[model samples]
Target: MSGLYRDVGVVLRTYKLRESDRIVVIHTKENGKIRAVAKGVRKTRSKFGARLEPMSHVRLLLYRGRELDIVSQAEAVEPLSPMLSSLDRASQGLAALEAVDQLSLEREPDPRAHAMLVGVLRTIAAKPSPLNVPAFYWKLLAHEGLRPQLDACVRCGDSEPSARLVAFDLVEGGVLCRSCRSGQAISEPALELLRDILGGRLQSALDREESPVTHEVAALATRALEHQIERRLRAVAMFERG
Candidate 1:
């Protein structure tokens, strides 16, 4: 299999290699995450110069190499121009890309992960919301089977409709009831927003504008994602500072 193969993927990140070549990390629909060298891509007239940029959804032809795969041909399925039009959109979009890069494993075939990445990018391009990136993070965590329990306490099996849930434990992976109150303090509105995010009411949550509740949700989601990835995302930090 040391020859040409084709795949569709989203460019997760890229780095400089030599004088004119670049290393691209892509999350593909079939082969999962791959690192490939785009030869001479930094040159002015390189065919794949623009096609291989981070956040681009691309279809590629690659030649298997002893070490890094070589990108032979690339075509853009979805360019990231729309999402990069503004600081707000770009920041959120880039943060999501970093999340995908962190969560994806090399050579692991995860079609669902690929689908989710493309879906979120398309959503951000069409309608950039404050909730979009955080929602993506939460959903990604859920897809990875680390979904935080929202219906009841993480400690006790309290499912009463009026059971007091006051805080979220990022380490424990769920909400804490009044008796087991710890971690980030969760307001009633914030808790409801979390439910809407994980409980099949995503559109409703996305339509709403930014507020204290959204901020709380974003913070919790960011912390949880950082915990899962075991490192800080540069894009998320920059977006927050900006």
Candidate 2:
């Protein structure tokens, strides 16, 4: 556990370094999230150039360096090529990467986060449901202990049954009852959809006619995640732009 390491991970993103090298952002199962320099990867005949591309799942051999780890070798585990076959699938995959990249820290072990992302990517590749993206985000937040409080008034902890979610407070981190309401108005349907998302009902929750509040729920999840991680998520922004 000193100067060298090996891990199986998914490529989150890559930044070009000089002309023929790349700095790859990866979410590794054993070593958590990390960035390592893949030297000469941009060369015409480089071994790992294709394997190190974003959203690729591969096993990497790394050597510790003073500044950045160097990728000594890379072998493809699951290239995840299907997820990149269409624009929709590709967007979902990249957004998933951005979400994981923002939520996780470098060199931290997060098996739950890692598995959640890998599973979500596999699901998206198969189904490509719109709700899957937001559901993935909310689920990741729940895993990180940032799930929005939906069962009661955030201020009073009043658990009395109410249809309308009424208001949501990002700072308070949940919904506020009518009596304790100084938050953004959100509908009961939105709250229910969010609940289903957390409960792993991606397809069923989105099976009916699309509700306007569904977009609101996605926005809320993004805002909540950004609030916790304190980083603006380009995943949400870019996905919406498309």
Candidate 3:
């Protein structure tokens, strides 16, 4: 591999290196997820300083190396300064970035995931709503093959509108009907909204305001994702703290 130039990408995470350098993980439209070293980025006067911050979108000229690529130059595509100014929104944005970092593999291109991340970041930067952030999580998890079945009961596949009990089984990947809810716990309203979310009804779900159903859905989605990933995100704890 030789030197290559790529268009802008969103910085997902960054770690300080020796002296004045850092390693950055970014999701690019052209190259998927990439890990590269941003030389001298930590220096006070470094031109790349702002461009390498997490959540900052940047265009890069890279030099492919044996172990990792080197970020030769970077230009900020979106500053995202206002978004990072809010601690709450920043926490959520970091969590989302961490989730993407955990879920994506090196060098593998996932256009859907890329687009979703970009969209989620934009939403956070513009509005910073907890509701939208959680919904974005649910959607991302679903796109990565962890979608919970909410339309019909997981056990019986029954499609009724009046089922009071809606049990979600992490191992089962969906909800269980009333008849099958023998030893299960569930929130009916949450399950119903989850069904709608899985069915691409975001506007309706968001229109419900600050309903308990939304919280339940967010909780359920978080639990389901943790179960699948086998690790709780550090950012979740920070988000809760704030």
Candidate 4:
């Protein structure tokens, strides 16, 4: 807390401060979330301005201050040009960034969540797909121990979900069996997609032929995350707009 410290971080969000300074929220691999001031960031020739953009992975050097730290130096560790070049990829990547910002705590380390953010952003940069956003949401939820129970009923513990009108209940936080049906009913196909996503079969879920149910799964995943966090996410709304 005295000298300059360095950490690998993902720029989550930034707010303009005064004329040239800015407040940046960064999620680090070792220090979780940190709100620090980046001086002279509004200047056109600022070296680290682009590096502080949301979803940019950077190795940051900081000096701890009384209330917030000051970003002394930042080197882009993972360039986000590929993801930013495409609007679709950019939206998904931003949603991942915003979701992590909203769901995480300040100064608390969650390396798994940090790694998941980096992994998902890299995936978006490498392969821009509609499923990556929801996959990131699902992975974050699971990291927070809010993983939906799709294998069996949330109430009766019935594993033969096919026999029932497969539905996911946000209130119950998982799939509901026939005997415990509570929320809106979903098709078996949609339920299967959710299962595939939660079961670590992301490639299968994404590689599967395009279908209406995939959108349904996206909506379901978004709703589930929103319900857990108890707030509508701006990134989710923005992604839905396009």
RMSD of each: 1.3, 2.2, 2.1, 1.7
Quality of model 1 by C-alpha lDDT: 0.89
Ranking by TM-score: 1, 4, 3, 2
Predicted candidate 4 versus true structure: per-residue lDDT over 1-242, tens digit per residue: 56689999999899999999999999999989999999998899996768888888999999888888999999989677887788888888888888898899999999999989999888888887778888778878988998888778888887772547467788988888777888878788988787788887888876765568878888888888888889999986765686
Give the alpha carbon lDDT tens digit for every residue of 1-242 in model 2: 58888888999999999999999988999889888999899999998768998888888899888878899999988757798789889988888888888888898999889888888888878877767677888888888888788888888888656533489998998888888887688788888888787766766775645458777787787788788878788866765687
Clashing pairs in 1: none
lDDT, each prediction: 0.89, 0.83, 0.77, 0.85
In terms of TM-score, how similar is model 1 to the real structure? 0.96
The order of the candidates by lDDT, greatest first, is: 1, 4, 2, 3
The runs of at least 3 residues in candidate 2 whose Cα sits more than 4 Å from the true structure, single-residue gaps closed, are 162-164, 200-203, 206-210, 239-242
Best by lDDT: 1
Residue-by-residue lDDT tens digits, candidate 1, 1-242: 64889999998889999899999999999999999999999999998868888888899999887888999999989676897798777777788889988887899989998998899989898899899999999999999999999888998868657678888998878998888888878898998998999999999999989898899999999999999989988987776687
Candidate of highest TM-score: 1
TM-score of model 2 vs. true structure:
0.90
Q: What is the lDDT for 119 in model 4?
A: 90
- Model 3 quality (TM-score): 0.91
lDDT of 3: 0.77
Positional deviation of residue 228's Cα in model 3 after best superposition, in angstroms: 1.5
TM-score of each: 0.96, 0.90, 0.91, 0.94
